[model samples]
Target: MSSVKETVDVAAPLRIAYNQWTQFEEFPLFMEGVDEVRQLDDRHNHWTTSIGGVRREFDTEIVDQLPDDRITWRSVAGDTRQRGSVRFERIDETHTRVELTMDVEPTGIAEKGADALGVIDRRVKGDLSRFKDYLESRGHESGGWRGRIRPADPGSPL
Candidate 1:
């Protein structure tokens, strides 16, 4: 497994930053290679992505979610095996810091080679940078889901 960690500071409040992050369907706008994300429910999502010329689909289940703080998820079933978390920190009343950490398992030669060449790390960083641009440009979130998902509630709905 390979891991990538990246951080970015956005000119928005913690609530705005965190709220934007919850709209998974908008990820394709800022997240490179993410073709589409369907939020099946509050704690479930289906992702379709094309990375390094390879297209894949995956389903993820949110393991834990804390409003305006952090959200964690792991792939439940799909063509990829991975897990990740996003954390939100308040820098000030109008500034926020967002951090992302992900663990990915590369399958086949192409993916393994890309991971070995630090492509994944660069991608993560670029994605976060774009996210900063996206939120900063809008000056607010398009919409938000502030609901909490506890570890004990795996099938929670939005």
Candidate 2:
């Protein structure tokens, strides 16, 4: 598995930054290589992505989530094998630090080679940078889901 971690400081307030991130369907606007994201439910999302001419469709389930703090997810059923988390930290009233960490298993030789070359790491960093710009320019979130999903208790919404 190849692990990638990246961080970016956004100009928006913590709440604004966190809220905008919950708008999963809007990810294509800022996330490169992501063609579409459909929120199946509060804890599930379907994603379509084309990276390096490789197209993939995946379904991810949110394993844990806390409003304004963090969101963690794993691929439940898909062509991709990965898990990741995005955490939000308040730097100040008008700024938020977003950290993303992901672990991806390369399926084939091409993917493994790209991972070794730091292609995925660079893409993740670029995505975060674009996210910063997207939120800063908008000045407000498109939408937000404040619901919680705890890994220990799937049926309970905390």
Candidate 3:
């Protein structure tokens, strides 16, 4: 499997960074390829993505999640296969570092060719930058999961 990872430091607390991400349904607000996300279960989600006019849908299972630390997932079934993790590190009481690592195999030869040529990296980086900007602009998480479809409770904040 091939991989691409990127990191960014945010001027926000770790909980702030983490809670925002835990709300996966909000991803389309920052992610470009994401058209929609529906929580299927606490650890499962369905996502729709579109890039360069090609649209695909996939279901992924959250392999692991540790609040204020990391969230990992891999495609359970889809047109394309992918696996990735987003890790959050508390740099200080008010600063956090976000790292993303993703390995993806395109479903078609055209998408594979584009990946070999660096298009995918650009898209990934752009998405991260957007997330950074959006998070910073918001200054706080908009809200959190209210749907009962989630597998586990968020529990009380520490």
Candidate 2: list runs displaced more than 4 Å.
Answer: 153-158
Assess candidate 2 and give its TM-score to the true structure. 0.95
RMSD of 2: 2.7
Clashing pairs in 1: none
What is the Cα-based lDDT of residue 59 in candidate 1? 98
All models: lDDT?
0.94, 0.94, 0.83
lDDT of 2: 0.94
lDDT of 3 by residue, 40-94 (tens): 8788899999887899999998867877778888888878688999999999999
Candidate 1: global Cα-lDDT?
0.94
How many residue pairs collide in each prediction? 0, 0, 1
- lDDT by residue for model 2 over 69-149, one digit each (tens)? 999999989899999999999999999999999999988788899999999999999999999999998889998889998
Per-model TM against the reference: 0.95, 0.95, 0.88
Q: Can you rank all candidates by lDDT, best first?
A: 1, 2, 3
Task: Report the lDDT tens digits of candidate 1 across residue range 1-158.
Answer: 99999999999999999999999999999999999999999999999999988999999999889999999999999999999999999999999999999999999999999999999999999999999999999988999999988776456652
